[model samples]
Target: MATVHNNSLNRLSAGGLLISLGIIFGDIGTSPLYVFKAIFNQGTVTPDLVIGAISCVFWTLTLQTTIKYVLITLNADNKGEGGILSLYSLVRRRAKWLIIPAIVGASTLLADGMITPAITISSAVEGLAIHNPAFPTVPVVVLIISLLFVIQRFGTSIVGRVFGPLMLVWFSTIGILGFAYIDKAPEVIKALNPYYAIHTIVHYPNALFIIGAIFLCTTGAEALYSDMGHCGKSNIRVSWIFVKLCLILNYFGQGAWLITHQGNVLGENNPFYAIMPDWFLFYGIIIATVAAIIASQAMISGSYTLISEAVRLNIWPKVTIRYPSDQKGQLYVPSINLILFIGCMLIIFVFRKSSNMEAAYGLAINLTFLSTTILVIYFMLRKRIHKLWIVLFALIYFTVEITFLVGNGVKIGHGGWLTLLLALTIFIVMYAWYTARKIKNRHVKFDDIKKYYPIISELSEDETVPTFASQLVYLTSANNKEEIETKVIYSILNKKPKRADVYWIVHVDVMDTPHARDYTVNQLIPGKLIRIDFKLGFREEQKISLLLRKVIEDMVSKGEIDITSQYKTLKKYHIPGDFNFVVLEKVFTKTSELNWPERIVMELYKILKNFSLSEEKGFGLDSSFVTLERVPLNIPNTGNLQLRRVK
Candidate 1:
């Protein structure tokens, strides 16, 4: 049976649609604030420029956001869980090289997280400059960003409640605002023609740069697919219809306003604010600011989710994750939050303006979109979609994305290199963590548990050895029921010779499905040895200490095992026996020989291990009852022994 993963708002309902609007659409929804302004800044505002830009925005949303993500990619969910990693998990068996795109997509998306807040919040706050030209927006932006990160520890459930309603208002206001201006330049509707989009690029000056600016409108498209798990596919798909309409209206409305001011340079005057009525400008600014905050929140929360998933997938090092609320899937990672906060602060100080930050924004996300495109094509291939359909889908998106990439390539010299640099740094960490594990696994040796059963049985009854615990448990990596790690046997019979009344070998398998929590128990020896295998989803918390207790309780209820202490004095009282856990930690040894890449990976892995959570902590085991054993990880040197003994 498939495991059922439930979110309160995961079902299709009015509430779900509202939540989808709030959570999934924040990044793309708020693009109207700066997209037109960025486009207008590129060249003179004319009939061709305004209409062409709006047309490009419309098709990008339709092709990239609406068709690609909402209609198609949302269907590729892994047991209703969606993200680059989750998608990778679904089709990963199809190809090994798929890991490259998954890592690249995730890293770039995370890089986008840092710039999204910096750019969106700065754009909203910069509206203050309209009223007071000398107002310093940096400190205000910094304060908002800082407080946003600060409150992340307390959870966002309370604040999250207002997101849907607030975003609804944001979308409605922008749509209405856009509709009001469309009458000023009815011909702006001509932007719907593909000809205008083609002509603008072919005839317009700096056309490639315009396409780069236009790419910003669909930046939040990936979030729709990533967050499909939070809100079901139905909710996201339905909410997107309404969202796309409002976004189109707002973009067209801005075009209308800009067309009316043709031939005049829009000198630092934002067309977004310019279209608003004098009476509603302040209110509009306030609404935009709140929407910007909502967008930032979505990105921040998404970053946390991404890092947590990455950790579980073994691509990222283990870090401390705390659940501050009773809500499912709501977690806070302080290390990630601190890193994002620092990245945002650095962008604000360095760029100092949303315009400059915009130059850095779309480039990283373009790479992310291209990576998603690559994954989706493979996803289609896996589904065995018709060859013609798959080829057409691949050709269209690859061409569009590569074009966007080249257009955004212009940003490399301006400010785009910053986000690319951030993404590259993140990729290195994931690559090193993942590659080191593969290398480590190559050296690990397993022993047949059947061969040691008699020896362990003898050790349990041996009066010469002192008792280690009433019940001793070891977490094992061996997947087969009849096998255990050679080191595990070494630890028991060779290292210190631990004796116990009962021995338990526990193994946890992280599955691709998001919420699996089933386990199977086997009695390797009656009343002497037990093996329990837990099949948990990647997103499931690994609280082995608590989960083991629950498993023991269930076993006790079923009369599967004896819990009474084996000691003579305690046997009379019928008290429960003590349980101790042994966690083997591998330490890198200098004697191990590796190729250059392996050595580099192991060296970085060593540094990362020092900073990461301990094995016991990572497994969610209690420290007091857990024994940490350091095991050397040594690969045999291919060369002959250098030291020779004198006979």
Candidate 2:
């Protein structure tokens, strides 16, 4: 059961609520930094456009973020765990095609992971350049993002406590500033009317295109649901009330400021900072920078959880994971960390400003939103929820998201392609890894254990065969105790004729539950052959060596087996016997008989296998006492060639 675990689903409390604010709201909370500016960037800032844009922001947040995600999607938690993957796990058995949406949604969320930090930090740091155009904010952005990544190894347990208070101050400041300005232009409140949202689309020249920026205001909504398990639904739902209020107040404040400057172009000047009184500018930038960093932290943490689950589900290549703290779901993957750092640096180096990075941002996450929508609808259907609401949910989200997708599509050449490209790359890897596993299992031959029991038992007592180890163990993928891989049989009898006092077969079954840990043991032979099936949750790490050792200790205490060394002197001294593990490594040999698709899958599987963690480390086996055996996965003589008998 050892791995990074998140207990965010523990209970409803003040601490949880605060953590929810600090963590769950970072993405959406920081959006005021750039969302309004992106809308104005598309064209001239007219009163109608400003009013329509603010209206779109309000309604979009209401419909997209609040209703769709916080209210509906958050209900589909996997054992109180929420995320696209978690939701998929709840109903994946309902249909095979569901895997597609799961993979695509998860990939896009990860893509969002890359772009969010770049844009959030870039937006915050851009405030410095706002005051002094000569200020070098690029290096500052790089430095802040770099420091965040560097600290992941230490864990966020210590700093996470302050995220809530920090965000509290940020929201309070934004709300106060916005409320203060609301008096300047009370007419801006008219934008909250849904009519203004519809009017913007009809009257604004680039209204449809502005949906891209509108999508940004709620980009973090999915993340909110994703982290629901970390912060109980009650905590999230409660904190959201405050978070949304402040966010709306700030958006309205910024709107109030924007409408005043109508017909006057605010080029390269952010309304968020512009709306702030001059005295508070420095302090405001400081608070925004801190909030942005925290936002980036939450996103990065979410990425780790996403990839960790992907690995456990066998959809992604295995990588080394380190638990930097006892906190649930706190894991550090060096590979992903480095990849994100490089990606962020690339975004900073290429996009150069928050506005440019914004162009690359919301495009991929819209795909994520749509993907989650499909899963959520199916999940509701499975729960026997009324069909009427399901259809309504689907229609409303599809209409809004498709419009946003098309709007973001216009940014394809303007850096949007970057995130889409990264997401597609991740999707391919996941698809390839998933399909290759199925293909590999398709050709594997599982033999009846009864047929081999006699051979195995006979060979165990045969003194002529060399003693392999006192206790010989093999990890098996077979779910049935009556079956074993034929390769294991051949390795035991034909390869080196390994003989041992007792043979142990271990099978691990990954359950869908987040933290389940139940196991069953079968004693096929009282003193010679034994089988163990461990049922672990996908979130649980497989520490086979340690677990097996504990199993042996329990057995020894019960006098089930004598594991003392076979040597006379050692047995006299009561020295414990040695245990050795045999790990099977597959080597695929491409034959001409393989079809193109099969070959492609096998080739990719091999390439991925090369980069993936080795079976020894992935399974948490003790390398010092393990032996690696390579087996050829060659098709058994597909005699398709018509040849003369040359011999």
Candidate 3:
């Protein structure tokens, strides 16, 4: 059994709590940096507009961020995992059509990954220009980004330790600042009223701008769902309440400051930092920079986890993964990290400032939010959660979300196309890779059962065969008759007669969602040989071994196999039998007939296939009873060496 850390209930230590705060809260925590400022600076500073914008921000947080995520979506956790994929897993079987929305949601999230770091760090670095007008913001931003990427090789554990205390201080500072300004302009607090928001939007001439402005307040809410597994549902829930309280206080404080210094606040350049006294400006800069980096860290780490889940589900190409800490689910993918870093740097260089990047930002975030809303509706339907409730919630949320999407849609000419374009590109690549792999696997058939049944039965009767013969298991293609004939031929040629009471043809189906439990079975073939297949639901985090044992027990009880007698010598009953398995692998050499993209995708699949689970564990066979026999099968195709047809 894996070591279970005491990260639950009272067992959680101070260190763990702090790390969770920093790593998980960074994205949402930093929203205060530009969210309110973004809304206010849209060329409308009138009392009605300010009141309306703040009101919209308030309701967006209360209803969309707090109510939807903290209350509803968080409850939808899959054994403590969250994200669009996790949500999809919970209802995919019952609502498979939901995959379309899930895919769109995931695609938009990928777009967010590329742009968030750029906007965040650029916004923070822009603060430097406030202290010294001569300081070069672009170069400084690039330097910070470069340093961030350099440290990714070491992983997040060391850095995570500092996140909690720093954010605690940051929030405290914002709250204190807000209190200072609230004493002077207390009426700003009244913006919390929903009526003020509705009134401002209705009475204001060009009220539609509030749609884009409200979208800013809920920017990182998806992170709440995506990182749900890293920190358990309870940790996030508890942490969020505190986080939200702090955020609201700070926003009110900013509004109060703006009210007190009506015409004297700094120009559009640095409104967030402008409210601080001169004595505190340096300190604020340091904190803002650190907070920005931390926010980017959350997105970076979340992106790695998302890609890992995608690879496991066969929606992404396989990349190497490394876990820096022994902590469960703490993983690092180097390839993804580098890609994100380079993309972010390019975005910063190309966009040059946060103002330009902001136009590109909302499109990705809004699309992702809209997609999640759609998926949540499907989830409600699958669970038979009342249709009236689903429709009512969906209509309200969808109308609000789509309104923001349209505002973002208006940004298409102004850098919004960048995010949409990136999303589409990734969607195409992922869709193509998935389609090609499925097509290739479908065409390649495994051997017939009759061809191998007699041999397996003969092997079962051989008493001379050792009780435990090998240490790995291999599976034959379930569709290749020629491969089966060759395997029989090779067994006779080698004089070993391929030994194992059970030889499995294993097929792993990576569904779109995380699984609640692993699936295993018996009698895929029957008495002579047991064909075991493992099905992993997308949300399940447990390794294959535990699930395999459960399957064995179920099979034994059903009289599918006699484990009781097989383990008579052992004190406790356990399945006992020496089993050897062979896997048939094919190496495809592309011919002229195949398309270039198909060939490229196939080659990538081959590389990914190398990283897949070994047949022994994949089929649920005990290590003592498994043996891997690799046999290669080749097929003829067109001479272009790009296209191949299976006959």
Error of 3 at 631 (Å): 10
Candidate 2 per-residue lDDT, tens place, 1-647, comes to 11123463347787887778888899999999999888887576677877788889989999998899888888888888888888888888899899999999999888888888889988888898866899998889888888999998888877887888999999899888888898877888898899999988877677656888788999999888888777778888888998899999999898888888888776788999988988999999999999999888988988888888888888999999998878767778888898788877877888988888877779989999999999998999999999999999999999999999998998888899888888898898899999888877776789888877888899888988878998899999898789999888888889899998889999998888877877777888877889988888878888989888888888889998788877679889999878999998866665456688867877877788888999999999989999999997665575766777875
Q: Per-residue alpha-carbon lDDT of model 3 for 271-358, expressed as tens digits?
A: 5776678899888888988888888877887787777776666676656667777755566878778878877876886788787787
Indicate whether candidate 1 or candidate 3 has the larger TM-score.
1
Sorted on TM-score, highest at the top, how do the candidates line up? 1, 2, 3
- Give the per-residue lDDT of model 1 (tens digit) for 60-106: 89889988898888989988888888888888889988889999999
Cα RMSDs, all models: 2.4, 2.1, 7.0
Best by TM-score: 1
lDDT of all predictions: 0.89, 0.85, 0.67
Provide the lDDT at 75 for model 3.
76
Backbone steric clashes in candidate 3, count: 29
Candidate 2 error regions (>4 Å) = 1-9, 636-647
Is candidate 1 or 2 superior in lDDT?
1
